[model samples]
Each structure stands twice: as structure tokens, then as C-alpha cells.
Target: MALVACLAVALPAHAVNQDDLLPAEKAFAAQVSRSGDKLQLTLDVAPGYYLYRDRIAISTTPADLAGKPVLPAAQEKADPYFGKQFIYHGKQSIVIPLAAGAPADFQLNVRLQGCAEAGVCYPPYTHKLKVSAAGGKTESKLDNWLGGAATAGKSPAGNSELAAKGWLTTLGTFLLAGLGMAFTACMYPLLPIVSSLIAGQGATLTRGRGFLLSLLYVQGLALTYTAVGVVAGLTGSLLTVWLQQPAVVLTASALMVVFALSMFDLFTIQLPNALQSRLAESSNQLSGGKALTVFLMGAMSALIVGPCVAPPLALALGYIGSTGDALLGGAALYAMALGLGLPLILIGTFGGHVLPRAGNWMKVVKSGFGVVMLGLAIWMATPFLPASLVMLLWAALLIGAAVFLGAFDTLSTASKPGARLGKALGLLLFLLGGAQLVGLLSGADNPRYPLKLIAASSAEGAASHPFQPISSIAELDAKLAEAKSAGKPLLLDFYADWCVACKEMESEVFPQPLVAAKMGQFVLLRADVTANSDAHQALLKRFGLFGPPGIILFGADGKEAQRVVGFTPAAAFASQLGQVAH
Candidate 1:
């Protein structure tokens, strides 16, 4: 009896509960309905469960009765089991195209696999439905419990399915993209503003108070962003275009200049005495109004500070404008803002403890922030500034920063360790500044690199492959006709100045000798969507492309051979070209 009791105590807690695991039917319920010669399969997924978008398969009994199933856009998730994949939670819908003169009845088979949030994955499940058609009306043999039947000549499932697919995908993409944008040059300036707000909480600052202030600030940003996106969607105008106007750019640059001056202690902008007294009183009483200042600042930052355009932002705006669905658009924008604020929140919470409280070092940190603000101001004015002038401004900034870092100062034996570190950084900056000055003199337009020497060396040997720019569907069709007449394959590249991936391809991938050599075989054409005009949008729509950095290849027979989306490395792209050539 003692041994039995000991064994019982030592044994694992309890046998896995089979009943707790969700059955295939309970986890995912499928419904088949038909509308206007198209069959729609809608899946009502249970909460805490998801189905892989790519794992879904649909076929017909007669084989030729239906074409392949067209899956709706699905939310992207970084799954532990499957790396990066698209999945659908809540509900999803897929449309299958039917062939002409279809039989009155056919068997539709669907095979799918899914998993519960509890980490239990179910095996592939297949469901067969007898689909009957008569007088443009259709019904499934399965019971209506799974939404299998639809009212004749009417679709019970309206645009909700389409909205679901778009919203889910948009939310996922914007959230991830925003996180990446948080670390970019456009968003970096806001970090100092957040840090300063937390630092202003004084010596008694606590983590809880810091978090509250940060949350309020982020909420304000998110709300403003959502509002702007919705308004843009309703108006059918791209806010980024207006924001990037020369006048607006100059005004924003001037505002940043003022902020930078304030940080440098050149002057201070303070509220009136009465307003200060009220704020002090509110802070003393621990009123919510104490955080309102930061909130307003966050809103201003969202609207005026960073107006940079990106592919995700453009895609979202375009979708919202086309669909006029403010709810989903707002949700996507809100998620993006949350992602953008994540880094700021982390910095605000932990920086209070890590950063030096009050010292000479604090002044240095403020001055450093001032320099960054100045750089940001210059960057905002780039559109208005001449290319040469921009390079000169960059050179001046780098050289001035180098001088501040003790590049010109002689370090004595008694110099602090910081002085040594500063000198090293200064030397590096000085070299970079020198390189920029040289590039500026040589009229090299690339601000990121001093490429004049390299360009001159490679000019003779470099392949001279030029791309004919096309902005509209008409132009693209004409170009395709010309290519076909010439008996040459064609490569269409979608590019945008605001797209980082496009720039990466231009600078890193396209410049490769192997890639350039292979490109000589095709007629290269480019559609620059930087303007995002009606024609540009039409071109993108014609190609079924969401945004720039998309490439399409057409064979000599005038048929689209392959399409490439997003960024591809040089080696991979070269291999793809080789295969296409063969």
C-alpha cells in the first residue's frame, strides 16, 4: 500500500483529456454556397483555433467542373510550428470559379488542416458536398448547420467575407511593418521626445507612473492616426502626397528646428505662469490631466513629425479608398500605431532607471538629441532642397557632429575614458564627412555612399540596360505589344522612391554583374508608383499588385511567365533569371 501511494505521487499529474481537445468539426465548420456562377466556401472557425490558408485544397468530382479554389487574403503569423505562414482565425471565405455549362449536380471535395490554440494539431480533414444547380441557383447537399445552403439567386454571405480577408491581412501586415518603421529614421526623432517626457517626471518617477504616461501618449498617437486614415479613405485622396508638399515640408522642418533649438538650451518654450500653476496643481493631485500634455505632444508628433510614405501605408490607404470600409481601415491603422509606439513605451519605462538622473552627462545627451533633431529637420526638407545642397547639408552635419565629439581636440593623459571613445567615433565621422564632401564635389547623387570612384571604374564594363517608364495600363499594354512584335521577352518592374525594398533591389541586387548581364536578354520596363496617381493605381490594379517592389516576367509569346513579389537577393534572383532564360 505504501509503494502504491508513492508510485501514485510520483506519476505524472493526469492523463491528457481527450474531451478537452476540440474535434475537427467543432474547431472548423465549413459552408458551401453558390452565387452568380461562383461557388463560395466559408469556414466559421472556432475561437482560439486557426486554419492555414495555403493548406486548403478544393476539387470537384467531375474534375473539369470547377477550376482551382481562389483563396482570400489571410492574416500572416510567425508560427512556431511552420515559420511564417498565412492563417485564418474567427472566419474565412474562399471562392471557387466554375466552368461554363456546368452539370446540374457535382461532388465538391475540400481538404484542410488546422490546429487549436492549445498546441493540438488535427490531421487533414476532407468534406464532400453534393452541389446541385438549376436556373442559375445552387444548393449544397450538406445541412444548413454549416451554412451550406443559400437562398436561391441571393448570397446570404455578403461582402463580409471579403472584408474579413482584407482586414485580417491588413492588420497583420501593418502591425509588423510598423514595428520595423519604429526603428527607422522617420520615427527615431520621437524617441527623444518620449524619453524627455519620462525624465520630466523628476526624481520620484516610478515605473507604474511612467507606463501610464507612455500608454496615454501612445493612445493619443493611435487615435490620431486612425482618424486621419479614415478621413483619407473617405476623401479618396492620399494624405501622404499633401503632407509631402514643399510648403508642408518646409513648415515641418522649421518646427523641428525650433524644437532642436529648445533642446540645445538656445531658448526655452514654456507655458504661461497660470497654465504652469494649473498643471502643477493637477500633477500634485494625481489627476489624469497631468498626462494630457504628453498626449497632445504624441498627437502632434503623429500628424506633423513623421509623414513618410511606405508600401504598407499606401496599400492600406488604397484599399480603404477603394472599399470605403472605415471600420477595418481604422483597426489596421490602430494596430500599426500600437506597433510604432512599442519601442517608445519600452524606452520610457526602462530609461528612467538606466539613464543618468542629473549631471553634465545629461546635458551631453540633450545636445546629442538636438543634433538628431537638426538632422531630421534637414531630412524633412530634402524634397525642396537641391540634391547638391542636401549633400552639403549632410556633410556639414556630420562634420559638426564630429567636431563636437572631440575630433579636433587633443586628449591628454588625464583625459577620461569617455574622451577616448568620443575621439574614435569622431575620427570615423570625420572620414565619412570627408567622403560625402568628395561625393558632393563629384556630383554623385547617392547620399548613402561615395560611389563616384566605383561608378567611374565600372562605367565602361557595366551593362547599359535601361528601363522604359510606364505609368498607365495603356502604356503597359502598348509596351507589351511592342515587345511581342520585337520577339523579345519583357520584364516589368514596379518601383517607388518610398519603398525601402525597391531601393534595396536597385542598390544591392540590380547592380550585381551577373544580374545586369542576365537582364540584357529582356526588354526592361519600369512603372514608378511614387506619385500614386490614378494612372499608377490603374497600372497596379491591372497587374493585381498591391504595391511597389513587384516584378513580372513575360515570355516572347507575350504570356506572363513568372511574377516576383517583395525583395529577392542577388544570387536568388540570378538563379531565377538563369532558369527563365533556359
Candidate 2:
């Protein structure tokens, strides 16, 4: 009997009776899981069945994915077809690296080639997995090949626009990235408190002390928001879309305008006199810890005057690679968190001192910040306003700035070098502001190219990349199936009017002649999530996307090939299309 069994197993791989052979899915069972920076794949082989280790290959959709599988030791076996090869018997688990800047979500294309020790060798087979940091979904090709099931499985979803290489590098990069955002927001509500922290009540704090405190404050700001935002994304919190509502946008912008008004010394906001007296009495009741009391006041003031100062990156940090670690996600938001803190430092230290002391010049500085806040408020409202109206606003702001800079001042004292410099800048701005007014009258709506008719390229119409718009999940599903059947690459864009980055892609990227030509290869579908209705919410949920400005690329086979989150420049977007969908 032993001899007979040995003979049965020793037969050539291709010599088995077809009727006795088990199906491939039964012969090799697979299970997938993820940990930290690695994806763990487990496969159970049936008795008398074996898999070729060298033939086992795993790759992600983007094709240039980092990391490789760390396969365990395999048995050396002589094969009639391929000579001696390393193979696995019984069951084996393999690990694939996934966390080298992997997107919060992606897909993995696995190639599992194996055969039975019985009479036949099965050819190499392909399997596709939809993966996110949270976990992966299995849609085995073996099932479709054997059973002819439809490939209509749901795709997976999270995350930040993309993850960082590692924890340390991510944190460091975010911290430095804060510098750029600070200038972009130009929000300086924290300046007063931060400067006060450094300058103290009556004395200047040491530079080292100021920095440490500022960092602490930023840590406090980043930790809560990023952790909450990531969890919120994973939980499908309404915060993402809810925050984008017109009422909310208007409210946030209004609050900012109030802060700006205060900075400009236009008006002072105070509690009713009756309530103010009671608050003073309560404050007087608590005598000790004057320092603590002062700190409390500063904290309250920061929250009230700058509620919007929290890092916008928090929303972008949504569902970071299913890290399940809020602190890790917070590290990414640290960039924007630091951005919020940076202005405080710069405004305080600009006068050559480590921090700003209360001085007459503070009026000028406050007014400057007020101007920035107004500009930001206007930017927020741009999507809701007409292009012509937006241009008029910009023109007005510029002309107002020119006037404020003493462009038309007649005082002879304007001969001072500083005054002369201001006048020069003011004159330049006045001219540019005049140009904006001219362009607005000339029927040019693009603020960047205010004088487009002068060029007469008529590029605007050519650049408008038309898209077939889908509103709900049902519509999207139908469109996707149609695209798949048409044998073309599919490009799905998540867009909303409120999304500044989405508009950037619309104006700057999609219109590029080369980009447009490349886009012709795709069946373009845009999900206008502008309404944020129940169906719209469901559509976003289907793809695990948090907000607008996301692009999903699918191959002709109907499997997702790549995901592009946030703004992608035309050159890079064109290059990405070069490979097309793989």
C-alpha cells in the first residue's frame, strides 16, 4: 500500500486523470491580512498538492509599487517540466511590504502559479484584491474562471491623499510643510497669544522657551483634530461634507471677517455689560494661580478668535492607511498644525527680538493680518460668486491696498525711503488692479489670465474637458459597467464646486492640450458631489472617498488601476497617463 501511495504521488504533474483532479480554488485556498507595513497572505494546499515558490508573484496596481514578499523556506523538489524547484506543501504564509508611502487605499494584483502532484499541472492564474489600509477584499479570478461570475465586486476605499514612507519621516515632513501653509492661510489669530507667551506680561521669554511652548500648543492642536478626523473618515462621519455646506462656509467666513475687523480696529466686540461684570466678579473670586488664569484667558481667546485656525490637513489626513493610530495620522497633520503656529512665531520675531512686545507698531501689524483674513474670506466665497464679480472684488481689494499704502499721498514726508518704497509697490498694484477691471470688462473670466482675449488663442473652450456626469451610486455603477463593456480606460473624478483643488485641476490641468489628448483615451466620468445629498453620500461611501478632488483610474478589464488624490499638475498627470491603466 505504501509503495502504491508513493507511486501515486510520484507520477508526473501532467499525468493525472482529469476526473480525479480537484478544482484550483479547492486545491489552493488563500487568505489575506495586513499588519503595519506588510500584507500577509496565507495559502492552504490540499494533500498531494504543491505550489512553485518562484512562480508566486505579488504586485500592486500602480505597477511601480515598493516592497516585495518575504517568502518562507520551501522544499526542493524535482519536476518533470521545470527541473528542480523550490515549492510549498501543506500551508504557508507570506508577507508583502505595503507601507512605503502606499496610498491610504489601493489594489493588489497577485499572480499565484501552482500545480498538483497528481496527473495535471494548472497554468499560472491571476487574482485581484481591493486593498485599503483597513483591510483587503478578495475577488478571486479562480471563481470567475471556474464559475463565470460577473466581475462586479465592490472596490475598496480611505485615506490621506497618500501615506508617508514611515512614521518619523512623515512627522518631519509635515512639520516642515507647515511653513508653506502658514503663509497661504495668512491667519494670525494666535499671534497675539503666542507673542504674549514669548514676551510675557512684563518681560521677554527666552527664544528656546517660546519655541517649546509653541510646539506644545501645536501638539495639542494636531493630536485631537487629526485623530478625530481619521476616525471620522473611517466611521463615515458627516463632518467632511457637512463642513462644506454653504451655511457652514458662510459662517466660518463670517467669523473670520469678524476677526479681521477686530484686527483692523474697526470695532471691538465685548459681552453685555451685565455679563461682563459677573465674569469679572468670578475672576476676582479665584485669587491664586494668576499665571494659570492668564494662560486660560489666552487659550479661550485663541479658540474664539481663530476657530478656523486648526489645520485643514486634518480632513486630508482622513483614514491614513488604516493605521488605527490617531497619533500617527496626527503626525501628517503636524505640517498644517505647525503652519498655524509659524505665523505666531514670525510675527513675534520679525522685529529682531525673539518675541514682540506691546508697541504702537502692533496696530499696523494687526491691520496687515486683517487684510490677509479678508482676502482669505473672499477666496472662500469665490466658488459661490460669478467670475466677473470675483474679479471686481480682487480689483477692489488691490485698489484699496494701493490707497492704504499711500499711493496718492501728497505729504512731502513721503520722500522717506520706506514711504517711497511703499508708493512704488502701491503704484504697481494700482496698475494691476486697473488691468483686472479692464479684463473683467473685456469678457475674460479667468483671473490668472485676465486678458485672455488679447492672446486670442480661444484655448478656454478647447481646454474644457467635457465629462459625463453621474450623480448617484446607481448611476455610477451603470456608467462603470458601460465603460468596462466599451473596452476603454475609465477616469472617474470626484468634484464639487467648493473644492478649490478640484477647480485647479479643471482650469489648469484638464485643459492642457497634451493632457486633453491623453484623456481622450478614457471614458471620463465625473461624480458631482456638490449636492452632498443622501445619494451623493452613498456614492462617496461606495468608493471610500472622503471628499472631492479624487481621481480613480480603471483599466479596460474594469479593475481599478490607480487612485490620484488632491491636485495633480498637468505634467505629472500626463506622465501618469503615459502608462495608461495597467
Candidate 3:
């Protein structure tokens, strides 16, 4: 009884107090701005709670003096947090930028969320802030300071406004730029020289409607890019006004982590190629038929280039939203698109005559890209997670992607069905081997259990049921006590809803008949840490657990037998349980 009391509920609320929760009396001032326009508003956050990621939702409800406005892209930036751990703090401020021509007295509504450490999370919060623009020495001084960092007045003029000779030259320059960027990203910088080596055939873009149409299509790309830039400029001003210096570092690092994973395909979910092909073909067919089609093409291009838009684009959007300069926001996005797509346009026009066709070596280049991508994915997953878990995920994705790409290549070739099928399987082996190189980085399953499922199975010389969710620490202690009084072994599980591995165990290992049959020999107790249960909180403190999905075994004497921090297969868990039970 004494042992149980010390390990179980000894933790009190005052043990490791977080930040103090302020009373409702405290208030803070908020600012709203769009481009050169600015508004000062008051914001009052509830005591004991803090604003977190994606929690702030900005709206232009009261209508700025200029009119109801849409915040631009490129101006928004993510707010930062101090700790790597997933704890929420209690204070935050959001900056709003004003558009260049926004009116003097603009109004907007703000909605946010608040959280505290007492397991008492608050409901969503809302506020209506009224801001009046400043037009004096202060505005002038601020403009002078911001002129160097802002992107307003930076975009090139529209084609309609350029002289004939200048327009043609500009078009040529942009086309070449788009083509060059495309080629660079393709990673086949030397493709032109090897055009003749692929099946002894040289492909060329002939001078005709197809060529002319391609150029026209690119104009749509340019316009869309400009539109995105305007959006960026508008939001950039808003962020510039509202962004707090304290949260910047934390926000940047968290976003960087997410971006890095997305780039390396660690947790990415891409659409099927068939969907992509149909969309591209439909857009091409609709060229010049409708304005909407052109807009769709621009959207499609944005999606295609999304992977390459990373840190810079994210930062730009954050800045724009935080600020509120629609014009400047548009400029930044246009610049980015121009930088990314300029080479594609250039290659389509002048270089089509001298360029080489696609080749078999393109496959090699693709494979190399895959290797680099996989390596980065592994690196990104290494920071806060276990090496073996990262390797397993990496290995699975590599194997799956290799199989997919191999089959795609074989099917794309104009070969016999039988030959294609055979080629796919063979090429799949190559991709698999290439992908397995990541295994050199990490992933060795525990030898004793061999299942990586976190626990042992009866067949593996252990007697334990597969993983199951336990409801509370009190329930777990009761089971242990009862088991000891009856001279029986006990198995205890501590799991949470947010822990992905726990779900995996419940679905994969627990329902197995073999593990279920062996369950009758021991007293089983499940502690579910999913909700903010007081008992679960006590259990968390008892085990000094930073996170969830914990497993513990107790012998007949009611002492802690053993514990595992993460997922262990049934066989491994069973072995540990069996040892302690005997």
C-alpha cells in the first residue's frame, strides 16, 4: 500500500507549475495595417490561456476606410513557440498590415483559441478591433524604415503597358528564364547533348500552332503569378504590423521541420498520375477557349511547383498576411514564379530548336533524385523520433515508390503487355535495392521480441495479451492489487489518442487470436490517457512520461515488473511479461 501510494497519486498540481494564468482584468493593444494604411485596435485575451498555431483567424468585417479588403499573401508569417515540447503558453499578439491605399478607419474581427495547463482548455475566443490610420511624421518615418524591406513597387509592368519592341524582348527574356529554371529543377542540365542517344530518335518542337499555343499558355502563367504576388503584398503589410518578435524563432523552426518532411516525401500524400494527366490535358485543350481555363492552368502550375516553393514562399506569405499590402504581396509572388518558371518559357521558344530529347538516362536522374529525397526524409525524421521508426517508414515508402515508378516506366513504353509486365517486376527489384540504402542509416528491430510491435507473443516464449488501451491509473492499480491478492500476473497499458503507434498496436496486434487466447492467464488493466482524465494525469506523473503509449507489467506481489516506452510487438512484450509473471 505504501509503495503504491508513493508511485501513483503523490503528484500534486503545484509540483511543476507552468506560467501563471492571468486574471480577466488584463488587456493588450492590437494593430491592423494594410500597405501604407494602419489601424490601432484593442485586444483582450482571457486569463490562463495562450494563442497557438493556426489559432488566429483574421477577418475584415467592419470594412476598412478604403473598403472591405482581402488580406494579401506573402505578408503572413507563422508565430513561434519557445519549447520543443508540445506545451501551450498563455500570451500572444497578432500584427495586421494595411494596404497602400486602405482608408483611415478600417475595422476587422479577430478570432483566436486559448489553452492552459490545468487540463481546463478554454473555448474559442473572439474580438472586434477598430483601427484608425496614422498620416503624419510617424507614418513618414515608418515608411522610410520599411521601404528597404518591403516588395511594393517592385513588379514589372504588364505586357499591355509595354512598348512593342520592349514587350517582345521582355517576353523572350521571361520565356528563356522559365525554361532555364525548369531544366535546372529537372536535374538534367546536360539533356541537350544526349538527345540523339535515346532510341536513335531526336524530338523537336516544330514551328506551328502547337508552338504558338504553348507560348500563349505561358502568358496565363505570368498573369496568375502576378495575381498571387498582389495577394502577397497585401498580407505582407498586415504581418509587418502584427508579428511579435518573441514568437518568430519558434514558429520558424516548427515550420522548417514540417517543410523539410514534406519536401523529402516522409509524410507527403501526392495525387495519382492519372488525375494529374487528365487535368493537364484538359487545360491544354481549353487554351484560348475560356478565361477560366487559363486561370485553371495557372492553378495547376502552382500545384506542380508547390514542392519547390518551400521556405521562401512560406515566409513571404506569412509576411504579407501579417502586413496588408496587396500590391506588394502580389509582387513577391510574381517574382518567385518568375524565378521558378522563367526557364520553361525560354526553352519552349528559342532553345526548342537546339534542345535534346528525353532519354533513358532520364531514368537514372530520376533515381538519383529519389535517393536524395529519401536521404533528406530520413534526416528530417531523425530529430524527435526513434531511428528505427524513421527507417521503417523510410524503407516502406522507398519500396512502395520504387514499385510504383518501375511499373509506370514499363507501362509507358510501347512494348508488348507481357514484356512490360516482366520489365516492371525486374525494374522494381532495382528500385527496391536503391531504396534499401537508407537501411544503412537506421532500423534494427529488437532481437528479443523480433516483432518491433513492442511486446512478445506466446509463441515467442511469452504469455501476454496483445496491446489494449487501459482507462485509468486507479483501475490499473486495482488490477495489480487484485492480481497480487489472487497470486496472478498483471499487464498494464497506458496509451493516448494522439500516439499513432498505440493505434497501430490496437489494430494490428491486439485483435490477433493467438494473443487473445493467452490473455486469460493474467489480470489486464488498460489506462487510456486520451482525454484529460485526472486519473490518467496522475498515472503520467507517476511514470514521469513525457508522452503516451506506455506499457508496464507487474508480478503477483504487486510491484512494477517492467515497462516499455514505445511500440513493441506482441512477441517482445509477451517475453517481458512472461519473465516477470514467473
Candidate 4:
């Protein structure tokens, strides 16, 4: 009876262990198919397993049989073994470019690694595939499998269909993004520019002339945006970053201040008398000269006045970089610019009829614009100032504006509705300004909210896992080694004072309790690239990154697990952390 009980327990334990083990081939199945000059590698991963995107390597037996593969963007994951990484689950397909005059048959080698959901990791597995290519003149089996031929002189019907769909999607996304950006603070200054242009045309301006001038102005803006976007996309350098430098910001702010003073009638900005005479003579005959000037102003507005980076611009640039399709990218940018200029067009065409003409009301409107310009100037200079100083400046501006609006003035019962409204707005501003001043006095950095709302413990927790500063690649490598030795993950953040997205991340994402807790499990490091030193440039180049607002996570094994290129929301970021830390 004792022997029977022992055998019963032993047999069940052995069976359970056997069922837990899965064959490598069953876990990850890879296949190769050729279509014209392109080779498609497909992997069907089992439900419980996922393959690493960066860990997958391909090589031909003849070595020169094929060029490097063009990989699609993979889904981002935070891996337990690797910090942050790109991975593929279920069905994954990768396209490889074949060389000309390649053999009809070649031995293709695929090496890959993956992990099971149950915390089981497999060693790197190698699969040898016998790949047969179809003739250059004929479509291969992959033609049906891949559903397209990417080679030259082939049926581009599939390619065209795909391109058309992609273009429409990109165009729609950019259009919406452009419309949203039109109302942003960076675009406010351009409103006065458009209003001034239209209002300056005098009472003799006709609707037909107004429409023509507006169209011309918008065309100039769109063309400049398209051209700059194409160049920036091709070069993979965003001009917004360079324009955000402290020196550049200060110069731009000073120029805006001067413009604001001019708006307040402190002084007039005029061309030399001889130049004005020549311009007047040119405009008298060929209206094209005036249009040309308007066009130049539009171009300058795009390049200098409102150089804010939006999601649509980043999306278009990313697509251009990946596909090297400048034509499509340029068209997308043009569409977006037209959308952004749509309001300007409307204002230029109809503003003359709507705005009060050559009266005290006009002066009041101009003064309001001057106040707006001053606000923009302060906004531009905020990055260079301490957070506390920025908050105080904002408070001062609001309080001063309230005083100008007669917030403290007593209103009679017989006062006009407009006067009452003005006093009411002024009071609201005064209250908000008072709140901000109190927050600043209480050591709050954020100008948007008061400090007393946050508990002391939460405030302490917010600063607990602050990022360790790193400046050089050597320092990064050393940190990675330390993290590996300690069996912990590493999170490297690329930051810059001028990077708007970076500031957003710091303010909105990193301070979240979930993000902070997840960060505590990793060796937190930050590389401030605001200086753009050679070391900073090298660090960016090493990761193939163009600018800041990039986050890279490395696993306990010292391998990069995930990479996030731009600003990610807190919820999505927390999801990423869940994958690796949990």
C-alpha cells in the first residue's frame, strides 16, 4: 500500500513537468517565400510566446545573395529580460531585398529568440530555409502570399493601391492636426499679421481683391511649409529643435516685444523712403509685386513666427524617413499647411468688413493684440527662466492686465453692459492671478495650479526617483554595466530644456504615481541634450535618434528592451512599464 501511494505521486509530477515543456519549433514557426526581387519572411508565433524584433537576424548562404531586410515598425513592449524592446506576437512578416543576378535557389538562415508568457525563455534558435526565387521576369509564389511586387518593371497595381490608402490616411490625420495647431499659442502672433494685412488694404478693398490676396498669401505659406518639410524629412533633422535654443528664443522674444510696442503706436516700422517709393511704384502697376511681398511674409511666418512641432508633422516625417518617399511626404505637408492657413484665409478675406474702421475701436483692438504679443514674448522666454520665475511672470502679466481693465473700479447701476462685462473679466483675471501668486510664494513650480492641493507625501514621492544625469556614451555604458550587475533594468531618458515634448513628459507623465513606482525598479538616467555638445550628439547618433524626448529601456541582461521616440501619454507609458516590471 505504501509503494502504490509513492508511485501515484511520482507519476503525476513527471507528467505535469513533461506537459509544461514545449518544443522550440512548435513555439516559433518561420517560413520564407520569394516574390520577384523581394523575399518575405513570415513567423507564426504560438499564443503564449513572443519574438524579439531586434533579436531576429537574417543571412544568406552565399553572403551576397540579398541585401538587408526592410523591417516594418514593430509593437513596443517592456520585457522582463530586456528593458524596453520592439516585439512581434502571433503572425509577423518582414520583407528582405534580394540582389540582382541572385541564384534561383539559396540557403537562407534565420536566427531568433523569444520568451514564453509563463516566464520561460528559450535559447536563440536557428532555422535553415531552402528559398527558391522566381525569375526576374516572372512573379513568384510570394506574389500571392505577399500580395504585392515591390520590384521595378513589375505590376505596380498593388503598390499603387497601398500607397493611395496610406496617402489618404496621412492627409486626413495631418489636416486635423493642422487645424488644432492653428489655435495654439505659437500661432497667435500670426493672427495679428493677417488682420493687419487685410485691414491695411483701406476701405477701397473689394471682396474679389480680398479673396485673391488671401489665396496668394495662403499659397505662399503652404509652399514654404511643403518645401521645408520635404528637406527636413529627407535630412531627418527637425528645424524646430534648432529654433528652440535659448539664444534663438531670446532674439525672437525681443523681436516680438518690439513688434508689440509698434502695435501700441509707440513707433512705426517702415521701409526706407526710397525703398517705399520703389515698392509703391511696383505695386501700382503689377499687383503681383504686392502678392510677392505677402508671400514672403507668409513664408517667414511659417519658418520663424510659429515653428511649433505637432503630431502630424512628426508622423509625416517618420513616414518619410522610413520609406524615403519625399513626394508623398511633401504632399502631406502641403495639405496640412493649407489646413493650418484656412483660418488665415478667412480672416484676410472678410476681416476688413468685420473689423471697425479707423476709429477708437481699431486702436483698442490693436492694443489688445499688443497685449497678446507681450504674452507670447513671455511664453517664448519661459524655457530659459526658472519655473518659479515663470510662474511669477505669468502672475504679473495677469495682474497687470486686470489692473488695465479696471478690475478695482466701482461700476454704477447705469453702467453699459460692455463696461460691466469688462469689469467681470478683469475680476476673474485678478482672482486667478492671486491664486498663482500664492502658489509661487508657496514654492510651487507649475503656473497652471496652486500648490496646497497636493499632499506633502505625494510631493516627496514625486521627487524620490529623480533621473540621474548622464552626459557621455562612456558614462551610459558604465551605468548599463552597473544595472546588469545588480540585476535591474535601466531607463534612459533624453531631455532638453527647449524641447516642448520633453517638458510635457516631465510635467505630465513622469510625475504619475504608476510611472514613478515603475521607474523605481530601474536605474533611472537622463541625458540633457540642451547643450547639443559633441557628447550629446554622439549619444543621439549611437541610438539613431535625432533629438530629445526619447526614452530607452534596457533589460537586466544589459540589452535594450524598448525605445520610445517622442512624447507618450501616462496611461500608454504605464502599460509599457507593466510589460517589463511585472
Assess every candidate by TM-score.
0.40, 0.40, 0.34, 0.38
Select the stronger candidate by TM-score from 1 and 3.
1
Cα error, candidate 1, residue 134 (Å): 29
RMSD of each: 18.4, 20.6, 19.0, 17.8
lDDT of 4 by residue, 262-349 (tens): 6667876544668646644543333332667677667656643332433234434544443334576577678878887877777777
The CA root-mean-square deviation of candidate 1, after full C-alpha superposition on the true structure, stands at: 18.4
Residue pairs with backbone overlap in model 2: 14-119, 15-119, 16-119, 174-335
Query: Model 4 — TM-score against the truth?
Result: 0.38
**Between the candidate structures 3 and 4, which one is better when assessed by lDDT?**
4
Candidate number of the best lDDT = 1
Residue 521's lDDT within candidate 1 is 82
**Candidate 3: TM-score?**
0.34
**Model 4: residues with Cα > 4 Å off, grouped in runs:** 1-238, 286-361, 452-582
In model 4, the Cα lDDT at residue 527 comes to 95
Candidate 1 least-lDDT 10 residues: 1-10
Report the lDDT tens digits of candidate 1 across residue range 432-458.
888888998887765666665466546
lDDT of 3 by residue, 1-582 (tens): 011111111111221222232221221113344335444332333332333444456666444433333322121111111112111222222345555665566456665443332222223334444544443211111121112221111121211111212434433443343443444333232122112111122243343433343344445555676676576555553454343333553355455556545544456434467876775565445434233453455455655555454433454465344434465445545555655544444454445555456665444443444444444434333443454564555556556555655544535556677557656765674455444443434344321122334333324423344434555666666666777899987777666554444554554455555455455566776776666455666676576543345566677788877776555566755566567765
Better of 2 and 4 by lDDT: 4
Candidate 1 — which residues are off by over 4 angstroms?
A: 1-245, 271-357, 449-453, 456-460, 464-508, 518-567, 579-582
Better of 2 and 3 by TM-score: 2
Ranking by lDDT: 1, 4, 2, 3
Sort the candidates on TM-score, descending order: 1, 2, 4, 3
| Tens digit of per-residue lDDT, candidate 2, span 234-332 | 443244334345787567667667766765567665456686566445534433223444444433433333333332332244223223344455555
